[model samples]
Target: MARQGRKPKGRPVSGWVILDKPKGMGSTEAVAKIKWLYFAQKAGHAGTLDPLASGMLPIALGDATKTVPYVMDGRKVYRFTVRWGAETTTDDTEGPVTRASDERPAREAVEALLADYTGEIEQVPPQFSAIKIEGERAYDLARAGETVEIASRLVQVHRLDIVDVPDGETTVFEAECGKGTYVRSIARDMGRDLGCFGHIVDLRRIAVGAFDEEDLVTLDELEDAAQEGREPLDEAAIAAGAKARVTDFRPLDDYILDPATALCDLYEVTLSDDQAGRVRSGNPVLLRGRDAPAFCDEAFATGQGRLVAIGSIEEGSFHPKRVFGGRH
Candidate 1:
């Protein structure tokens, strides 16, 4: 019997592409599009963005996929609009209106209810959701006309603010919340409390973890930059000095973020070349730096400004869990 390392076909491009997904595009479709554009061997997205929602979708290619969970669990910011007087089955404009109301909430009423939604709260997800139920997707059952009782979950909403009362029928809101917080649920529940049924007319995710809306690369921008297809990358090129790392990836356009960009929230340990070499080889190393933590549940290590590995630190020693190959 023989064992060998797995080698990826195609260019082993790796990095985070913070896509500003346009409305009506699905998260999976966006990920696939990026993968095709970069010709990456592996790719995945951190969070799910609905087909109708638009904004920051952090897509990880190759080694960056390892950091997906950390970014997905991080805080998110959304700017959404809710239309009063009708609640839909899906809690958004795409679904049929299930409840209608002649009543509309006042600006003061909406603002007062903001505090009620803030902090830890119980939220019922929309009927049309990806959540699983008895081995089936909730949305599939919903679309097939089968009614299922969806359980409510505890989610944290750090802050909610009424950005504008655009009209008597619509209100724009901005929310900063922890993972699993649904903007649609907020609209539905707030409407019930205000005595006016509501549904989301527009939803946009402005940020996820370390990525901000300002860091977004639009779909149009990406396609425009790729008029000339990407150049072949040696997998290890990202760590091969600054100039090659910049010019070798693609055109002069700044489309990709560092693979470690999604790891900003993690505890970081800067390592020496020798230690990095050991870490890259799947070995543990003592955290000899003066600022090293005695213990940490999760942390990432970097050497010579290149990502080395992500692991946990126990008793002043860093254990390599998912090690990055080919330098960066």
Candidate 2:
């Protein structure tokens, strides 16, 4: 695809990179490699995958980094294979085999257990994780051979479909879950619940937020493209990837949706230009736009049908809390 827009010159570059990460490389390694290729001073990945796992990993550069947290709030999907009868310290193949069992549940039995994992469930994160415990990273504590008790957090497993159940001691599963759901923990928990210890042997992320594996460009492909003077940031190339899905996709001249478009479906209150300017200036504005008996003391303002600013009414004025679409 032909490169769109002018080639940037020392200006801070901002865009998303959906990397089809290769195995044996950690998520941070992939980010570092891409950052070197782009010469981006700032970059971050929305979610992380184990070195043994590979697939859609969204790498946000420059200003795109600001949107990383928002993007990460979306659901994720993974296709992974679990080896039954073995439990690992890290819950994946990378960990040492801490325990083993001879029991192998039938395929029917495994499918029955999947149903119990669907919907909202409580899950404890793995010990080798970034979660902090008493101000120190859990992984740090784990590496120091310290036992840390991590609290269980509630997460939703939107869907858990059994992809394949081979006669051997391995079972393959495809699951869609909300943010913060740990697949490794699920694998370990499944083995325990099924009367057999288990550990993830192979795992591949199919989707992160709206980006899918099919849309990712492998590192080799990207290198070849770069060598051929193909810039993935080109509009055509980006449009073909996951960045296009959640992006505005529309021309700026066209009416811009409120930056809060994702939250538009929820309760909202409109404001006039004068009121919007006041709210933008840190004044508290009332939610008089809606006549259905104002349900909230908090009021938000919109300009040109897009959420321009949000604020809470205090003593008859709305003080702006967040302003979107403005040059930050």
Q: Judging by TM-score against the true structure, name the best candidate.
A: 1
Q: Report the lDDT of model 1 for residue 328.
A: 21
Residue 147 local lDDT, model 2: 84
* RMSD over all Cα atoms, model 1: 6.5
Please list the residue runs of candidate 1 whose C-alpha ends up more than 4 Å from where it truly belongs after superposition. 1-7, 228-249, 326-328
Best by lDDT: 1
Q: Write the per-residue lDDT of candidate 1 for residues 205-251, one digit (tens) a residue.
A: 99999999778998778876775444456757747742222224465
Please, what is the whole-model Cα lDDT of each candidate in the order they appear?
Answer: 0.87, 0.72
**Model 1 — which ten-residue stretch has the worst lDDT?**
243-252
What are the TM-scores, per candidate, against the unseen true structure?
Answer: 0.90, 0.70
Q: How many backbone clashes does candidate 1 have?
A: 0
- Residue range 159-265, candidate 2, lDDT tens digits: 99889977678989999999889888899999999889899988888887656655576777655544544323677776767332212212211211123433332
- Report the error of model 1 at residue 194, Å: 0.9
